[model samples]
Target chain A: MVRGMAFDTSRRQVVKGFACLGIGATLPLCCGGTWIQAVAAESFTLTEIVDGVHVFTGANELMNEANHGAICNLGIVIGDDAVAVIDSGGSIVEAGAFLAAIRGITDKPIRYLVNTHMHPDHIFGNAVFRDAGATLIGHRNLPRALAARGEFYLRSYRNQIGATLMKGVEIIAPTMLITDRQELDLGGRKIELRAWKPAHTDNDLTVFDPATQTLFAGDLVFLEHLPTLDGSLLGWLGQMDELAAIKAAHVVPGHGTAPASWPQALQPQRHYFEALARDLRKAIEDGTPLAEAVGTAASSARSDWQLFDEYNERNATAAYAELEWE
Target chain B: MKAVRQDRRPMAGTASKMAAALALAACICAMPSLAYSQAANAPSEKIWNELKTDVFEDRTIQSDTGLIRIEAPKRAQDAALVPVDIFIDPAKFPGGIKSLTLIVDVNPSPVAATFQFGENSGVTHLSTRLRVDDYSYLRAIAETANGELHMAQTYVKASGGCSAPAVKNQDEANRTMGQMKLRQFAEQDSQTGKGRELQLMIRHPNNSGLQKDPLTQYFIPPHFIHKLSVSQDDRPILSMEGGISISEDPNFRFDYTPDGNGEIRVEAVDTDGKVFRDQWPLEAAGL
Candidate 1:
């Protein structure tokens, strides 16, 4: 499901109203003056963590009009020769702001545009960079996954976010596929990209920057937001275990705030998915029907995450059916 | 007709006006189900009367809810392929089941399919997948040989059954349309006390006439399995007339008697008038 709002509806309403004021007050300022700088500053905010590495933190939230469709965490890695962008935001507007933010920091050409996965929140900004001559990069399964569900995702978003918000939302397939692992030299720094098994999704990839020691672990690590399951739960747990051993100083998650210890950032999600798998297996063993399993499985994790009501039951149903066959 | 508005109010005119009309009809078909919405958990007499009058044509129905058991996901993962299973025990019924009708209360063609079983059909068990078009109740009705219709229902949350895009290769789908394969499972039926459960799989695109071909950007004309029949030695035992709601690579399961030492024949005909027939013996097909 395409989520369009961040956490807490009351706060979102307030934020939406303030955003309206900010845009409205600047209408007159847009008459070819210092509006470009003012509009850029007010439209989106980016935090420069260290040199050549910047991140835009979308409210740990949903995808909607007020948020400018930036509901996921995206990052940029700049090297001496070129820059590699890790996941653009939900729409072209967000992508344009992201490109502007990159241009403000550096004049280097963007060489690599890596999508963590095919979720609309993370990968809908491909055309903006494609036209800018950035080669789209993704996991091996990304192109197929995009082809299979891309139109459905677009149609659903058009129905939900309105056509105006999705004026340039094109399902751009990745030209380069990272089969196992690929490394790119951004000037002196080298960024490592790995295509994963069917974990978070069939097309999940992680971008690891050794210079910064920051693992851009896309949807693989959800900090506070609930872990939405779209792929194999068993595979996801396996990936969590494998990723825990790799030492990284700090991590940038796809959706939430990541901490220094990247492995610790993954515990709650690992627990949630493990809980789902265990409960589903138990239900399957007991011959408890799908509806009943959906009603009861993983209820304990409901309070720990946002949008648990929307996604967990479906997660349980999918997990139950998969485990039932096995 | 209730009311035709200027530019057809709720939905936009993005799709072809004709396509939009069909889709609107699909949405409007969901209204009667909403009347049963608030009291959804309880089976209403009015709902049954409407179904009988419209689909069953004033046929008297008996309330034997527990006699029929339907299995389906409460919220389907894919709107186009919602798997369902219906089971009816002869011991529970006064007489054996003769006909079964599967209905999605919100689909454009709400009567998704109807299956008429012969006396040789053994136990009344059927399993298949359907396109659910919208969030509405799915009814699996079993009519006993004595002409008593019993119903089992589950509320499914899904949509786009009649119009979901076909993501498979169209050329490949066309090349392999109407191919049918039968797999027999070793499960005994209570009614015949001598047969096993049989499953038949048909490969067809079942284009809804609503989906656009990705390459051409033109609406793919509706081509689906218009008729499917199963027989023992050419004696028709069970048959189904499907529409756009039937999924591609459609799968179905039923009960059959294997005591006749005769071959089980399957015939599937597509909307394009192409007919495919396959048969298998109690043991194997090649032998």
Candidate 2:
């Protein structure tokens, strides 16, 4: 009861402070000053990957209040008449900050908002883009994924990032779903969106700008970060070659360093995935139980990735659950 | 929390301790969220105290008898796939164990399952995965042939923040529902002498249906395996009456003394009255 009361008190302060920040809005005498510092802290820089493609490389960390839930990469592809943004971000505050950054660069109408997948980190900010009148685009499976997990995401992330940062976050499903492939032309710049077959997730969608040959490989291409498996492990391993064959000069991965050279950037993750699969297969063949096998399942790749300790065992557990059926 | 952990009687034998250590280390590696760390400090026994009366009906359950031992991660790695192990000492139960009831105190469906063992069935070890919705006590209550109830319990910190106890691939689960797979291994139990181990996996969504469709605002209809039984040579080994607390693709692994080289058989029925049955020739011991 005490804990609940404490949480509610803090949440009320946040709401009160938020209302005071809007222009011409009444500043209540009870409003706390924490919201002022929080709002002022909302800013992130976007790196121009090419002439028309800009990538806002998020910090290589998990979603947290400190990071303001901006842990996954967000992209901005500009054109003469319109713009297409890749991934909304992890929280409403981060998305609001991202919108402000885009407005600084161009006044062009934000035409298309693309979601890479249904992970909370990538789609929590969907409301910001939807409110901006951008037509949301995602893989055909996105709606179902969101329907199944959207409420869970909201409840869970509120606990992770706190109510202050999650102020206006909402799970806005995409209206324009791509079943196979779709092309969006922002004036003369041509952007190709291809939905993959359940690689990193069931609804993974990649945004490729042919003009600059830059590929926005959502969570499908994790570099420094260990790849978390929520979909089929076999499906992801089987599609590695096809993903590498995408003709792109550079790639903006969902996490870690941005604009990495094509194909080569995937080698490290490929080795990690293969190594994990081999270990899990051996464990299964030896009749090792999931609880015992997962401890050392992917220990061989422990030195190769960031957050390996945090995500490896979970990946092993999920992978073991999948492979044991085979 | 400390008092409750300290209250647990020390598990006898090196094998049980080793198994407990391994399970703990694996669970520690799987704790991804820092949110649960704070929860460990605020232990709640209120739910368990209130739940016991409705479950056991005023029957006294002995906790210090050392007849049963239950093992689960202090913090679940995945809410949907929390592995749990229960070991019953054959030496303590001269009449053999009769039934085992598993309860996850905080889950929407608190009573996860109840398993009834066949007469003379040398079943001493059982392991299965469960879905823990929140920080709760996972207890295993065992009833011996003499009608004595002995219990062991462990607190599991759920991965509540991001991971819901929901199916990962709903489409894949639906497509493969009712499929069954079995694996066999040889075991030499110090107490039961020689025995055979069997791992049975059944494909089922085991949906709790507690979740509302955020779009439609309607509860997803609950569907899950409600009944399952396993036997060897026409002799019952174990059977369960389960609930949605079981993970998707329900799985069970256990050690039982093989009477003969008869075929091992399994039959499972879901809430929809769909029956799935399969059998495999019992592999020789020490394979």
Candidate 3:
């Protein structure tokens, strides 16, 4: 008990520093200046994807505090009158850097903050935007998903990345929900938001910009990174087919480089899903149990994707459960 | 952090080698200590005999292989909710099954559940989820109508599931705690007959009195479903006496023959003496 003083002290600091800069859960005068500087000094770089559409592509690394919780793709879309930020980074410091990045580019007031899904890396930085008075937007099922999974994700991530980096990691839920499809005008520019059937997650919302012919296809479209199946494998396979018909020129996926063509960028992920389905069918046909099916299903596609070893087995387990009845 | 890591690497490498050498010395010195621990850890054969006698008092135990088969994952991905399938061949048991009992030997409360088949019921198969706290031997004892008892046992490897974080926050879990949902698996409610599979999802934190609440840092109270009973219309189907080994939001899928498309009802009592009930329509739920 006495030996864990450092960890316990840090945990206390983390709980104390939970809310965003000077806003929610304000700290006392003692460590105020140092804490604010520590938060403000965290740096992040962004790439201008297109005219008025800037994106901060995350490092192709796992969750770690050194990256200041910027481990997912985040972007800002500047409309005529207001600015809309998409997918805030993973922590409070990242959220501060995100706000700074927006300030560096433009002084437009942020009106909307859109979250792609319920993943913590994409949603934990919501407090910064909320403090900026941006109305939060997410899929209809996002609230329930947050309710069902929010606390667990928070605690587990704190354990994984340590509490200091997770200080500002609070669940800032969506105020507005996208059911099927809705069109939002960020002034003159129109971005179409579509919430699909339980594909990437039970609540997966994608943002499409008609001006640049660009689709911010959240985790629905994966590039070099492996596709993760947290929702239905059958549903994801079907959703891919629906996404293919939507013609767009540029696709800014949730991870990796922006795809040159819209739905065509989904080819690798489509192949991964197809491989998973085909092998799972054979496993089910042969009465292969879940343990064996995990190893054999989609084993051939291991070399083609990143983090395949980390997720393939789990994906196979889900696929086996679904395909056994089929 | 980087400086600390860099400074420690060489020391760690040397420490491991020195530790290996010291381990050889320590093993010789700690022989008696190790033997004493082994004796303390191993449960006596008398305790095993006593537990069996306590659970199956005065009942004759016969070894009849292949009559009942228990299927569970060798390595559970989620220890909190490990799916266990029990299949008893009705053809092998011409006497018909009278009751079925599930037990996870290592759990604080070993008797996970008990199912009593209604009259004219030919239930040879059933499945349910369990929260296994540690690596343990699980048993499924089936009692035939003729008073013969047969048991099937398997060892499962799993850990940390009982204390893993609950799916939702404390407030949400408390508010939704006693809510239940029922659905038919293989057979739809409209065309239910014999050999139809049905699933029952019960909403309960099923706190094992082990996991600490994040905010309070105290063990959530040991309030869990202690007993559950299911009936179709007026006729009884099955009953269970659950334990801490039952997962949060305890769920079950089993074969039950429907008696003319009747509404299925379920009644459960928790450890705190709170009774919860829910029912499915004559038609399937959410139909």
Candidate 4:
């Protein structure tokens, strides 16, 4: 039998540490003069993509298996009066850490918490900000997405990890809903929120920071890695072109490192989707079996992109089926 | 003996004649019933027999001394593709190992992948993105210092991972492949410089065979990363073997002895032969 006893000490330490962190109590030893240093050490490091707008990359610390995409970049838009958080992150603890990071940088209250989509990793932390009085904002489909999967996420979190971290995490519904587009002013700073239909999800909202010429293009653009498909591939490809037309100086992807040019950042995703859609269409026309179509289409894309080898066939297959149905 | 002798006598002859008649009557009586049962129970019996054979089979796994360590979820929230990690203990196999194999008994194809490590490659660790066909035993057999296979097995609850969607977005997900991110969790306590954890995230679609392409009305093909390597300062620390059980955007954590300095590098090779590499510089905190 495999020895389970060897991991006990480490497991105990994790449980104890989690218990302390879960209650939000400062560790006693670190609470003295050393505590100040710890807090200073814990300060959220912000890398400025442009003046006034910052990307709060979560501490490269915390080995989270979830939220792998934006593990580093949590795009923060600081307005003159208040700050708007683009994605809330994976959990209440993470959101709390994010809020603390925000507090360290500026005293401005979080005026709005805009959700890019309904993915749990992006929206699970909504309750933390909502409890802190930030107005939750999202697309019209947000509520439905949350309602469908929120309980599942909660159960998974509690069952897989532990309940302490997710305790009291209420799924807060977005108070402000946008169907197509909406504009908001944060103390004279104009922020445009647009609902991109059936792209990444049923409804994906992108926040444009006009002053900084930065667009928080949620999952619309994943820099470097493979994109996960939830919505229509064709729709996403078209949206990418539209996003390229926006002419933003910087694009903060829902995941990956921030890109200096919005168009360049979105190109990889565009090429992938276009190629997938094109190949799938041809396969459907040729009457290629679904399995063969996936293999053939993915193999073709494999030579150009490294990540494609992992997901291309699957993407093609899914795109083919979705398109076939449509 | 007396009973046998008596039964064998003429008294038994009359009994035998009656027995023959009875036997004929019994065959006549049972033939239709036997045919009816065969027709009724064959399909159910086949399923039962398969289950019975699988349950009774002796599945024994042997491990090479230090070549591989299998890490499975203590409890998996989603049964479909439970995240699994395989690490090669460098100290145990100093000559630097080659080739890692994963055999998941419940899966349709038990042999997930066989990886050939590169030269001078601290390619001791691999993490793939995989699929688990069912709740069954999983084995990792590593060829070690002496060219013998060392094995380890862990029981994983199987969910229908093959059909899970690659992600919510087909296009955006396609763009993110080969992009790698490394995150270091909070430092250990100052008193104990032990117990450091690093999380590595790789972007991939991790397509399992079960998802229906909404457009084509067909099953998406299964493609996933079969191997991963995590190294520190050019030294091997963890190697992973992955299958369909690995979720999309596969993320994993590795615990290691801290030198308190050196860059941690992660390189992943997917089933389709795409390679991605990323590195993170270690920060020296007193802890």
Each prediction's DockQ against the real complex: 0.08, 0.24, 0.05, 0.04
- Give the Cα lDDT of each candidate: 0.66, 0.77, 0.66, 0.57
Native contacts retained by candidate 1: 0.03
Per-residue CA lDDT of candidate 4, range B4-28, in tens? 0011112344444443443344334
The best-first sequence of candidates by DockQ reads 2, 1, 3, 4
Q: Over the stretch A116-190, how does candidate 4's per-residue lDDT look in tens digits?
A: 887656776676677667899998877655553344355444443345445445566688999988988777677
Model with the higher TM-score, candidate 2 or 4: 2
Label model 2 with its docking quality class: acceptable
Q: Where does the lowest 10-residue lDDT sum fall in candidate 2 chain A?
A: A1-10
- Number of the predicted model whose TM-score against the real structure is largest: 2
Error of 3 at B266 (Å): 13
Give per-residue lDDT, candidate 4, residue A74. Answer: 67
Candidate closer to the true structure by TM-score (higher is better), 2 or 3: 2
B-chain TM-score, every candidate? 0.73, 0.82, 0.73, 0.53
Q: What is residue B182's positional error in candidate 2, in angstroms?
A: 1.1
Query: Which regions of candidate 2 fall more than 4 Å away from where they truly are?
Result: A1-42, B1-44, B189-194
User: Can you write out model 3's per-residue Cα lDDT over A111-217, one digit (the tens) per residue?
Assistant: 99999998877887887788788999999878766754464466556655667877756776798999999988888787899998877777889998777666888
Which residue runs of candidate 4 sit more than 4 Å off their true CA positions? A1-44, A58-72, A156-170, A300-314, B1-287
Can you tell me the CAPRI class of model 1?
Answer: incorrect
Kindly give the stretch of ten consecutive residues in candidate 1 chain A with the minimal lDDT sum: A9-18
Per-residue CA lDDT of model 3 for B1-287, tens digit only, reads 00010111123454444434433433342333223222323332333354577689978866546788898877664455567888988778877788888877654445677778888655767777676644566788988888888888887764221123233223334666776766564454454343766667676767655333333443334556667888988788877764556766777767776778787788876765566777766554321
Reference-based lDDT, residue A275, model 4: 74
Candidate number of the best lDDT: 2
